[model samples]
Target: MLRFQDWQENQREVFFPDTVAFKWQMIETFIDGEEYDRSHVITESKWLAEHVKQGEIGAQEEYKHYKFNFSGNGQIEVISNGFTVKM
Candidate 1:
């Protein structure tokens, strides 16, 4: 199993830099096998890029940073300020 920190580092060094270089309007996530909407949470691609560059695998809003948990089975759990969304 890969640790979250290690995954974060890999994201920062490779995945984000190579894949997430475009602008986005929203981010979707899943938690406990259920989808959750978070379109209102993140609206700027620059902000998201900044976090990604900073070795973060999640989003941020209102000065709070959300974290993410990546499952090896092509799934990701987004831990937001109020809820967890897995995708």
Candidate 2:
């Protein structure tokens, strides 16, 4: 599991607040790439399905496609088992 937090910066201080958080379980693959317009998770991913059909991945393994979007920065797309909301 990985934890990503959003922070605030000012003249007084640069601090991290537990406002918005991202917790991901990147069990299969992790890719940091350019921003994607699609901003959501794709369950029972076709992307992974293709790999499975092609014998790249085992049929026994289950994976989900997770896409995280940062305001201006590029996005990160990961193939994980699943994720939960921690608040």
Candidate 3:
């Protein structure tokens, strides 16, 4: 298992590049102390994408940042972390 600090640094260097740059102080991720695995980290969404601008289903107002939940397709509902919705 890689060190927690080491793995987190690598994740920041890898994922949010083009529109999102890797800023160690600016990143928020999950690193299970026992292991340094890619499967364990979580990346926060900026919610500044075009799909958000299209607006949400049945929503009367535009969303700046959202703490909404959607049940994904599957036998079990996947309730992901609340994400932001931006244009």
Candidate 4:
């Protein structure tokens, strides 16, 4: 398993290699009054692509499946483990 620091470092490398102008925007949704929540880090396109790739890899490794659905208004839903996280 990747440590949180390692994952953050990887994200930094992927999103901001030489420039510091970009930053991660936290996108979160509260479920059940914040007892359960879903969150994502909004970054550059390359970084988001890598994030999705990692999610796909994790699903395959765990023998699970993921379904991603996008709506017309730029909302995304990632369905996995019988739950959906909107992004």
- Residue-level lDDT of model 3, residues 1-87, one tens digit each, is 111223234322112112211122222333244122222222233433333445432233222221111112111111122322222
TM-score of every model versus the real structure:
0.20, 0.44, 0.17, 0.17
- Please give the CA lDDT of all the candidate structures: 0.34, 0.50, 0.24, 0.28
lDDT of model number 4 = 0.28
Stretches > 4 Å off in candidate 1: 1-39, 58-87
Candidate 2 residues lying further than 4 Å off, grouped into runs, are: 1-39, 43-46, 84-87
On TM-score, the stronger of 2 and 3 is 2
Model 3 misplacement above 4 A? 1-19, 25-35, 39-87
Candidate 3 positional error at 48, Å? 5.6
Best by TM-score: 2
RMSD of each: 13.7, 10.3, 14.4, 14.1
Candidate 4 residues 1-83, lDDT tens each?
A: 11122223342111211221222224433223322222333323343345457664342332222211112112232222233
Candidate with the larger lDDT of 2 and 3: 2
Pairs with steric clashes in candidate 2: none
Candidate 4 deviant stretches above 4 angstroms: 1-71, 84-87
